[model samples]
Target: MSSLLGSKEATNRSFRSIADLTVLGLLTLLLAALPLGASGYVLYVVNLLMVYVVLSLGMHLAIGETGQFTLSHTAFFGIGIYTAGLVNNHWHFPFPVSILASAAVAALVGWVIGVLALRMRDIYLALATFAFGEAMQWVLLNWESVTRGANGLRFRAATLGELQLVSDLLAYPFVVAIAALMMALTFAITRSRLGLAFRAVRESDMAAVAMGINARAIKVTSFVLSAAFAGVAGGMYTLFTSFIHPESLGFETTVMVLTMVVVGGLGSVRGAVAGAIIVGLISELLRQAPSYQEIIYGVILMLFMMFLPKGLASLVNGRVALKKGCAS
Candidate 1:
């Protein structure tokens, strides 16, 4: 019976793995084909959606997997934007260079914050991160020489030799490619030993420590990874937008990212991506009804939490489970 149970579990794992590969393969095909006939506005919207996917994945790593409650996602995102934009503007480095630098700088800052805030937990941790975000925004607003003080920073077009990504259509393929790469990386991480450590810490730091895990280190690692992903998202933003200001990087942006992760189902990478695409498009459409946008969005989120708290991913899981049971 024990052997039979083990075989069943192995078969289930195989099924999930095959399903994941199929979905990813189809997605890659779409991303590779999208820019062929897409309009300028469609490409622009898709670019932002990809950015949100990266941001939500970052949040999932930190909060969903590591159980860290941080409200400073946009702060790291802003850091990435400015770092990549400034580098591209001043040094004319390739987009990859600027993006990597942004990730490194953001990870460094996240490490600092994680070290300082590790002592706190729950609401205290959230508040502390929120305060840090507000402070970062203030700096972006007041740093006249650096951020251009509310006028917005207009960076040079991201370039790789003769290939210049000035327009949304021009940058669409790269943007989608980067976002897909991040998704694949996230999947790989969640299947590795480090991912097991993250989940153990998330379940209970004290229990994880008792089991010989360096829970604190895992938490800090999550923070750094989360920030790096956000920073990359920011760099992706610079590729097409070419301009940014303090106003766009605020707590609301953080809230939207948080919402995406939660609505997609916490701790599920597939959910985060789907949530980003669905919620990102909805948020974009909500712009037309600025006054009622918040109300409608809030209602939708509340309803999801109330009825489908496990998120859209839960439905997929249910279907998979049903199939597995039928096979058994």
Candidate 2:
């Protein structure tokens, strides 16, 4: 009777934990949706927020989950956008096909980079990746035969096979859907056995290797997957913006994406999402201010690093802890 009672109690605790997490997730959804209640510039900012969320999620998968520090996710994003643009603009292929091709190409490059750099320590890996990103930018800028050199490419209307969708307002829902689906997929991965392997590797690659886990393979897989997700977001970005440029892969853009992940929280998915939204909003808001935005941006980043080092999601988790304490 005692064992049975203990089992039942354990089950109940598990259910309660799941319920709490579900409620928190629903609340996050509600928060994301709040901008929809506004219009014009607000909606535009919300769209930008979604883009950053996707970018940060990819970084979270690589850095937080797999323990790989990449300083050049933006390069993969640029590859995806440019690949999709080339396919769509030159070949006149369907949008879905173009997006997939972009992801595949980016994944291939990511795999190659991972294979080459996995043997190096973190700092060396970072420098190598950064170099590759700079090289990509130079190639995109000077490869006139393909990328049109300094003058970027302009894409025509995007299509879904026989169907064609137009208007930014109409397309907003699709972008949101893609972002949501990608985020959910990321969450699922984080909850699976692969995620466990990733965590083990992150905690200690040597230990993970001792435990019979292929650390190099895990790192490479994570990098490829992260690049693929970033590619999806990039494809969507290019289609929405209808243009592609070499500057998209430059060092500054890379720093911005890295900042989103670091500021949010290294390993937490929620932190990645929160960081992306907050940083994206601040950047867009600063753009509007123009005069004092740079000063404000630098100050905000410093404050985040100094105080809320874990990002806004940490603040949310703290409130949850406080509420549970009160309930108890």
Candidate 3:
């Protein structure tokens, strides 16, 4: 009887593995086709979506996987932007160097926050993170010599490798490629051992600790990983906009990212990407509309939260379950 049960479990795991691989393949094909078939504006939105996709993934690593309700992601995001900006603007470093440096700095900040907040419980941790985010914005706003204060700093057009992309159409593919690679990396991490540990920590930290898992190390690791991803997203945002500002690192922006994760799905990585697309497109579309835009956004978010608490990802799961039921 035990052997039979083990066999069944193994079979279920195999099925899940297949399902995940199929999804990955489909996403790859879709990404490959978009730049070839889509319009320039569509491609531009896709590029923007790719960046948020990374940012949302980072948020998912904390909120969804490790159950850390952090409001300090925007600060980490700023770390990346300012890191790249300072290096490129002053030191004349290469793009890769700036991005790497930004990621490292953001990870350091995450580590510091994690260490200091180790003893804090839920809301306390959230408040502390929120304060850290606000402080980061203040620093950026007041640091005129480096950040240029409220005016922000614009960069000259950048190149990837030897290719100087003068058009958005040209640059769009480059950004998309990097974002896609990062997304794959994130997906891998979500399916690996560390991901299971993250989920365990999220579900019950005390239980996880009792099970011999070092909860503190898991929390800190997830935090640092999330911060690194946020840094990458921020660097991309800066490059795409050709400028960096304190507002990008503010509480409002942090809320925006949080909205993306929550509205998409709590623990669904793919859902986070989907949520970004929905919010990003809706926000851009409503930019020209009347005052109703903000109202519409709030309404949609409320409706989704009420009706689809698990998020749109739940719909996918439901469909898959239905298909399996039919097969069985």
Off by over 4 Å in 3: 1-30, 36-40, 289-298, 325-328
- Report each candidate's C-alpha RMSD, comma-separated, in the order given: 1.5, 3.7, 2.9
Off by more than 4 A, model 2: 1-43, 288-302, 320-328
Q: What would the TM-scores of all predictions be? A: 0.95, 0.85, 0.87
Model 1 — which ten-residue stretch has the worst lDDT?
Answer: 289-298
lDDT values, one for every candidate: 0.91, 0.79, 0.80
Error of 3 at 255 (Å): 2.3
lDDT of 1 by residue, 1-328 (tens): 8898799889888988898889878987887787788889988999999999999999999988899989999999999999999999889999999999999999999999999987799999999999999999999999989899789889999998899997998898889889989988998999899999999999998899999999889999999999999999999999998789898887778878888987899889989999999889988998787666556667777988899988899999899889878877
- Output the worst ten-in-a-row residue range by lDDT, candidate 2: 163-172
Better of 1 and 3 by lDDT: 1
Better of 2 and 3 by lDDT: 3
Taking the tens digit of each residue's C-alpha lDDT, what string does model 2 give over 12-104? 568658986897689568746755676655655666677788888988998889888887688888888888888888888877788888889
Better of 2 and 3 by TM-score: 3
Backbone clashes (count) for model 3 = 0
lDDT of 3: 0.80
